[model samples]
Target: MIQVLEVKTEKDIKEFIDFPFKIYKGDKNWVPPLKNDEKKMFSPHTNPELEFCDTQFWLAKDNGKTVGRIITMINHKYNEKVNKAYARFFKFESINVEGGEQLLLFAENWAREKRSTHIHGPLGFSNLDNQGLLIEGFEYLPSIASTYNKVFYKDIFDKLEYQKENDWIEFILYPEDCIDERILKLNETIKKRYNLIVNSFKKRKELQPFIPQVLEVLNQAFAELPYVIPFDEKTGSYYIEKYFSLLNPNLIKIITNKDGEAVAFIVGLPSLSRAMQKANGKLSPWGIYNIFRAINHPKVVDLALTAVLPQLQRQGVAAVLITELQKELIRYGVKEVETTGIFETNTQAVQTWKNFKHIQHKRRRCYVKEL
Candidate 1:
C-alpha cells in the first residue's frame, strides 16, 4: 500500500522537509539539510524563485511511515524562452521502486495538464538550486552542499526510458603536484604584463562591495548560458550572504583588468561534509555551532562557481587565475581541490583543468522524458 501526499500545508511541508531523516535512518553518508533553509527554498514568501516560477513538493508514505519525496517545478521564465513547457523534479528520495514510479507519474500527469513537452529531474526550483543526478562516484562522500543519492537511483531512472540530456562533470585536483614550471612562469608573466590584480578578501566586511560586483559580472558573463535564469537583486544578495561566511582567503580570486573593473571571478568554500553531516542542514541552536565550526576549518574545499568575462575568453585568463590559486593551494596543505561541475560540452573550461591533471572525479546527469 503506497500513497503520495502533496505537501501543501505547513505540516505536510514539514514532513516533506524531514523525510530524509526517516528514509536514510541508518545511512552514514547522508547529511540533513537545515530545516530553515529548506523552508525558505520552498516557500513563495522566502524563495526568490517564486518571482518567476512555481513548484510543488510531494512526500510518499506507506503504512504511515515516510518512504520518499520529490519536488516538481516549472520556471515560467525558462519554459517560455526554451520554447517548451519543460518541468523539473528535485529533492527526490525513495526506498522502493514502485513508490518512486508512482510519485513520478503524478508529476508526469501534472505536467501533461500544463501541456509540457518534457520532464527532467533532480533539479531544484531553479539553476540557483541543486541541479543534476548522481551518475558516478557514489562511493566517495560528497562535499557539503553537494548532492548524494543511493546508487540504485540510477537504475530506477534507466528503467523509466528517460533520455540522457546533459552531464555535469566534477574534478578532483592534485594542485600541488601538477603545477608545471612553464605554466607557473606563464602565470607570473601574465599577471605582471596585464596589470591584473587578484584581490584576496581578508575580512568579512571587505567582501561586501565585491559581492554585487561578482554577481553583476556573473549575471552578465553567463547571461546567454543555457537553463540559467537571471537573478533578481534579492536573490543575488542572498547568495552572497550564504557563501562569504565559509570563504578561505585564497579561495576567492577577483580578476580586475588594467582598468580596475572586475572582469572575472571564482568562488569556492571549505567543504562542510563533516559539519553538514552533523548539522543536517539545520541552523538551529544545536546545529548552527557545528556548521560554523566546519566552515572555519574545513578539510574539503568545494569550488562552487567560476566565470571569466566573454570579451577576455579568447585570451586564456582563466588559466592564470588557476595557476596562481594552485600554488596557494599547495602552501595551504589543501588535500584536493574540487572543480565546480562543468557542462561536458564546455571544452574550453575542460582544457583549463587538463593542464593540472584534474580527473573527472564525479559525473552528475540530467535525464528527460517527453510527456
Candidate 2:
C-alpha cells in the first residue's frame, strides 16, 4: 500500500529536496538546484513570501521506500488580488503513475478543504521561482532557471484529467545569426530619436543603484500576466541577494530616457547548468570552483529576465536592449543564447525572437483541474 506523509521534520524536508536527484539519475539534461538554496526557499525566516502563503510538503512512500513528493500552496495575497480561491501544487515528482496519482489526490483534497475552487501548478511562490512542467524538449539541457523532469510525468497529469491552463516556450539562439546589421543601426537611431541612453556595466557596483527601477519596470511590465505578484521591497531584496552575484555585468543592458529613469533592462547570466550539474546540488569547494570557472568562460548565456515599462512597450526598446546585449555576447565569445520561458500568448515577446536565428526547442505547461 502507498502512504502519504506530510513533511514536518528536518529529515522529511531533506527527503523532499533529495527526491529529484533520485529520479533524474543519469539524466544529462537535468540540472540540480543548490541544496542550500532549496532549504532557504522553504524557510519562513528566509523567504518573505511564506509570510503570506499557506504551504505544505508531502512525500509518498511504498513499503518504506519513497516514491513521490509534492507541495501544495495557497498564496493569500494573490487570491486577494484576483479574488479567486485557487490553490497550486509544485515540485511534483513520482516514480510511477500510481505514486503520482496519490500525491495529486492528496493535494486536491487539501485544496478542497481550504475552500479552493480550482488547483493549478507546477507554480511556485512567485514568477521568479521555477514554474511549469516540461511538456517537450526532454533532450535539451535546461538552464538553471528552467525546470526538467522525466517525460513519463506528463502521463500522470493526463491520467488525473488536468487540463492545460497555459504554455511557455523556450528558444535557443545563435548570437551570430541573431544579430542584424540593420537592427544595430536602428538601435542607434532609436536611441537618438527617443533620447534614450544605453548603460553597460563592467562592475556590479555600477549596476547596483538602478536595481530598484529595474524591479519597478518588471512589476509594471508583468502586472497583467497570470500568476504574477508585484515584487515588494523585501521580495526584491531577497532576489537581489540570491542572484545578483551570478550575473555577468557586461551582459546586462539598461536603457534610460532623457530624465535618467530606467525604462527597460535585460539581465543575462553565463550558463551555470553544467556547473550546477557538477555541484550535484551542493556548493562544495569543488562546486564553487566550477561555478567561477563557468562564469569567467561561458559558451552559453541565459537571458534570465527582461522587462520594459508598460508605457514604453513596442517602442523598439526591447530591440535596442537585445542588440546591445548581443554585441556584448559576441565580444565575450559566447556561442549560444538560451531564453527563459515566454508565454505562448505573449505575442509581443514572441515577435522579438523572430528576428533571431532560433528554434522553439522547449515547451513547459501549467495544468489546472476544477474541484
Candidate 3:
C-alpha cells in the first residue's frame, strides 16, 4: 500500500530535504544541497513567497517506508499574471511508477480546481532557484549549480503524461582553445571604439566601488523579464555580498562602456558540490571548513549569470564577455561551466554561444494551463 503525506511539521519537512542525500548516496554524480538552505524555502517564516503563493509538499511511502517526494505549488503571482491555473512539482521523486502518478494526480486535480487548462513543472516557486529536469547529460557528473536525474526519472514524467515545454544548454570551454582571429579583431575594434576593457575583479576591495552600480545595471537589464520581481536594496546587496564573495574572481568579467558603465558582463562562481556533499548541507565547525576550502578548490565554475543591457545587445558584448572569462579559466585551471537556466523561447541567448559548440546538454521545461 502507498500513501502520500503532506509536509505539515518540522519532521515531515526534514525528510523532504534529506531524502535526496539518501537517494543518490553512493552516486558519484550526485551533489547534495545545503540542508539549512533547503529548509529556508519550505519554512513559512523563511520563505517570503508564501505571502504570494501556495504549496503543498508530498512524500510518497510504501508500507510506511518513504519512497519519493514532490511539491505541488500555485504561484498566485503567476496565476494572476497569466490568467491561468498552474502548479509546479519541485524536487519530484518516486520509487515506483504507480506511486509517482499518484503525486501528479493530486497536483493535477489541484490545478483543475482552479479551472486550469494544462499543468506543467518540476519548477521552483520562482525562477531564482533550480527550475528544470535533466533530460540529457546522465553520463557526466552533475555540477553544484545544475540539475541531474536518472534516465528513469524522465520515463516517469512521460508515463505521467508530462511533455517537454522547453530546454537549455551548458557548454565547456578551454583556455588552450584560441578565439577566432576574425572575432578577436572585431572585439579589439569594439574595445578601442568604445574605450572599453574586459577584466575580472582582482581583489574584494576593488569591487566595493562598483558593486552597487552593478546591482543597478542588473535591475535595469532584467526589468522586462516575466515572473521577475526586482530585489530590494537589502536583498540585492545581500546577494552581491554573499554570492560574489565566494566567486572565483578570475572567472567573473565586467565589461564597461566608453563612459565606464558596466554595460555587459558575466559572473561565475566556484562549484561547491563536493563540499556540500561532504557537509550534508551543514555549516558547523567542520562543515565550514569544507565550504571555505571549496572556495579556492572549486573543480567546476558555475557560470551563475550573464547579462547585457538592451542598448548594448547584439553588439558583440556577449562575445567579449565570454572571451575574457575563457582567458581567466585558463589562468585558474578550471575545467567546466554551468549557466543559469535560459528561457527556451529566448533564442538570442541560446545562439549567443557560437564559439562554444554547445551540446544542449540540459533540458528544463515550464508548463502552462488556463485557470
Candidate 4:
C-alpha cells in the first residue's frame, strides 16, 4: 500500500526537497534546484508569501521508501483577485503512476476541506516562482528559471481529468538570427521620437540604484496580465534580492524616458544550465566558481524577462529594447538564447520574437480540475 504523509518535521521537508534527485537521476535535461533555495521558499520567515498563502507538502512512501512528493498551495491574494478559490500544486514528482494519482487526490481532498472549489497548478507562491508542467521539448535542457519533468508526468495529469488552465511557450534564438535591419532603423526612429534612452551599466554596483524602478515598472506592466497578482512591497523586495543579485550587469538593459523614469527593461542571465548540472545544485566553492565562469564566458544566454509600460506598448519601445540588448549579447560572444516562458495569449510579446529565426521548442501547461 502507498502511504501519504504531510511534511511536518525538518527531516520531512528535506526529503520533500530532495525527491527530485531520485526521480530525475539520469535525466540530462533535469536541472537540480539548490536545496537551500528550496528550503527558503517553504519557510515562512524567509518567504513572505507564506504570510498570505496556505501551503502543505506531502511525501508518498511505499515499503518505507519515498516514491513521490507534492506541495499544495493556496494563494489567497490570487483567489481574492480572481474571485475563485484555487488550491495549486507545485514540485509534483512521482515514480509510479498510481502514486501520482494518490498525491493529487490527497491534495484535492485537502483543498476541498479548506473550502477551495478548484485545484490547479504546477504553480507556486507567485509568478516569479517556476510554474507549469513541461508538455513538450523533452530533448532540450531547461534553463534554471524553468522546470523539467519526466514525459510520463503529463500522462498522469491527463488521467486525473485536469483541463488546461493556460499554456506558456518558450523560444530558442541563435546569434545568426539577429534582428532585421529594418527593425534596427525603426528602433532608432522610435528612440529619437520618444526621447527613449537605453541604459547600460559597467558594474553590478552601478545597476543597483535602478533595480527598484525596474521592478516597479515590471509590476505595473504585468498587472493586467491574466491570473497575475501584483507583488506586494515585501514580496517585490524579496524577489529583487533573490534574482537580481546574480545577474551579469551587461546582460540587463533598461529603457528610460526623457524624465529618466524607466519605461521598459529586459534581463538575461548567462545560461547556467550546464553549470548547475555540473554543480549538482550545490553552491559551494566549485559551484560558485562554475556560476562565475558561466557569467564571464557563457555559451548560452537565457532571456529572463522583458516588460514595457502599458501606455508605451507597441510604440517601438519593445523593438528598441531587444535591438539594444542584442548588440551586447553579441559582444559577449553568446550564441543562443532561451526565452524562459511567455504566456500563449501574450500576442504582443510573442509577436516581437517572430522577427527572429527561432523555434517554439517548449510548451508548459497549467492544469485545473474542479475539487
Candidate 5:
C-alpha cells in the first residue's frame, strides 16, 4: 500500500530532500543538490518567489519507508496572466512507476482542491529554477543548472496521460568552433553601428551595481517565453544572491547600447557538476576547494543563460556577445562547452547554436494533463 504523507515538519522536509540520495545512491551521473540550498527554496523568507505562489510538498511511503516525493505549485502570476487555474508539479522523484503515480495523484488532488483546471510541469516557481526531466543523454553528467534523471521516469507521466507541453533541447559545443572570423568582423560592425559596448570585469564588485538593470533587460528579453513570470525587485535580488554571485566575472558578457541600457547578456560557469558529485552535495572546506578548482581550471564550461532584448533580436547583438565569450573561452583553455536547455519552440535561441559546431545531446520536457 502507498501512503502519501504531507511534509509539515522540518524533519519531514529533510526526509523529502534526502529521498533522492537513497534512489541515486549507486548511480554515477546523479548530482545531489546542497542541502542548505535546497531548504532555502521552501522558506518564504529566503525565496521571495513564495510571496506570489502557493506550494505544497508530499512524500510517499510504502511499508513505512519513504519511496517518493513531489511539490505541487500554483504561481498566482501565471494563473492570472493566462486566465486559467493551472498548477505545476516539480521537484519530482520516485523509485518506481507506482510510486510516481501515487505522487502525481497527490499533486493532482491538491490542485483540484484549489480549483485548478489543468496541471503542468516538471517546472518550478520560475525559469531560473531547474525544470524538465532528463529524457536523453543519460550517460552525460548534467551541469549544475540542468537536471538528470532515470530514463524510466517518463513512463509514469505517460501512464498518467500527461501530454507533452513543451520540450527544451541542450547542446554540446567546441568553443574553438564558435569563433568565425566573418562573425567577428560582423560583431565589430554591429557594435560601431549601434554604439554598443561589451563590458568585462576582473572582479565581482564591478558587476554588482549593474545587476538590477541586467534583470530588467532579462524581463524585457524573455517576457514572451512560455510560463515566464517577470521578476519583481525582491525576486530579482533573490536570484542574484543564489545564482549570480557564484558566477566568475570573466565568464560574464553584458552588452549595452549608447544610453548604457543592457540589450544582451550571457552567463556561463566552469562546470562544477563533477565537483558537486564528488562532494556528495556538501560545500565545506574540501568541496569549496573543488568548486574553486573547477572555476579556475575547467575542461568543460556550461553556458548557463543568455538573452537578447526582443527589439534587438536578430540584430547581430548576440554575435557581439558570443565574440566576447569566445575570447574568454580561449583564454581559459576550455575544451568543450555544454549549453543549458533552450525551448524547442524558441526558434530564435535555438538558431544561434547552429552557427557553431554543436550537437543537441539532451532533451527534456514539461508534461501536462487537464483536470
Candidate 6:
C-alpha cells in the first residue's frame, strides 16, 4: 500500500528535500540544487514568503521506502490580487505514476479543506522561485534557474486530468550569430535619440545603489505577466542578499535615461549547472573550488533576467541593453547563451530571440485542475 505523510518532523523535511536526489539518479542532464539553499527555503526565518503563505510538505512512501515528495501552498496575497481562490503545488517529484498520484491527491484534498476552488502550479511563493514542469528538452542540461524532471512525470499530471494553464519556453543562443552590425549601429543611434546611457559595473559595490531602482523597473515591467507579485521591500532585500554574492559584475548591464533613472537592465550569470552537479548539492572543499573556477573562466552564460520599464517598451531600450551585454559576452569568450523561461504567448519577446541563431529547445508547463 502507498501512504502519504505530512512532513512535520526534522527527519521528514530532510527526506522531502532528498527525495529528488534519488529520482534523478544517473540522469546526466539533471542539476542538483544546493542542499543548504533547499533547507533555507523551507524555513520561515530565512524565506520571507513563509510569513504570508500557507505551506506544507509531504512524502509518499511504499513499504517504508520513500517514493515521492510534494509541497502545497496557498498564497493569500496572490489570491487577493487575482480575486480567485487558487492553490499551488511545487517541488513535485516521484518515482512512479502511483506515487505521484497519491501525493497529488493528498495535496488536492488539503487544498479543498483550505477552501480553494481551483489549484494550479508547479509554481512557488513568487516569480523569483523556480516554477513550471519540464515538458520538453529532457536531453539538454537545464540552467540553474530552470526546472528539469523525468519525462514520465508528465504522465502523472495527465492521468490526474490536469490541463495546461501556461507554458514557458527556453532557448540556447550563439552569441556570434546574435551580433548584428545594424543592431550595434541602431543601439548607438537609439542611445543618442533617447539620451539613454548604458551602465556597466566592474565591482559588486558599484552595482549596489542601482539595485532598488532595477527591481522597481522589474516590478513595473512584469506586472502584467502571469503568476507575478510585486516585490515588497523586505522580499526584495532578501533576494538581494541571497543572490547578490553569486553575480558576476561584468555580466550585468543597466540603461538610464537623461535623468539618470534606471529604466532597463539585463542580468547574466556564468552557467553554474555543471558546477552544481559537481558539488552534488553540498559545499565541500572541492565543490567550492569548482564553483569559483566556473565563475572566473566561464564559457557558457545564462541570461537570467531582463526588464524594461513599461512606458519604454518597444522604444528600443531592450535592444540597446542586449547589444551592450552581447559585447561583454564576446569579450568573455562565451560560447553558449541560455535563456530562462519566456511565456509562449509573449510574441514580442519570442521574436526578439529569433533574431539570433537559436533553438527553442526547452518547454515548461504549469498545470491546472478545478477542485
Question: What are the C-alpha RMSDs, in order, of all predicted structures?
Answer: 2.1, 1.2, 3.1, 1.4, 1.3, 1.3
lDDT of each: 0.75, 0.91, 0.71, 0.87, 0.86, 0.89
lDDT of 3 by residue, 94-154 (tens): 7667877777777788777766666777777655566677876776765666787666777
Write the number of the candidate with greater TM-score, choosing between 2 and 4. 2
Each model's total of backbone clashes: 4, 0, 4, 0, 0, 0
- Estimate, for each residue in 263-367, the C-alpha lDDT of model 4 and write its tens digit: 999988889888888888689999989988988786798999899998899887887777777888778777788998899888888777666678899999999
For TM-score, candidate 2 versus 3, the one ahead is: 2
Q: Which candidate comes out best when scored by lDDT?
A: 2
Candidate 1 residue-wise lDDT, 1-371, digit = tens: 88878887888888887777777766777766667767887666677777776777788889887888888888898887777789888888888788788778888888887778888877765566667888887776676556778788888888888888888888887666457788877877777877788887666677677766777788777777667766668877666555566676666778887887888877767777777777766666667677767556655677777778887775667887676666556665677777666788988887876766567778988889998
* Off by more than 4 A, model 3: 177-185, 195-199, 205-216, 219-245, 258-260, 284-286, 343-347, 367-371
Lowest lDDT 10-residue stretch of candidate 1: 237-246
* TM-score against truth, every candidate: 0.92, 0.98, 0.86, 0.97, 0.97, 0.97
For residues 269-311, write the lDDT of model 5, one tens digit per residue. Answer: 8898888887787889998888888877767889987888888
TM-score: model 1 vs. ground truth: 0.92
Q: Which residue pairs does candidate 3 place in steric collision?
A: 84-371, 85-371, 117-370, 118-369
Q: List the residue pairs that clash in candidate 4.
A: none
TM-score of 3: 0.86
Query: Given candidate 5, what's the lDDT at residue 191?
Result: 91
lDDT per residue for candidate 2 within 1-371, as digits (tens), equals: 99999998999989999999998888899999989888887788999989989998899999989999998999998999999999999999999889999999999999999999999999999998889999999989999999998888899889989999999999998767356668778888888988999999999899989988999989999999989999999999988988987877998999998999999999889999999999999989999999988887878999998898888889888988888888888888887999999999998997765777788999999999999
Q: In model 6, which runs have C-alpha deviations exceeding 4 angstroms?
A: none
For model 2, where is the 10-residue window of minimal lDDT?
174-183
Give the winner by lDDT: 3 or 4: 4
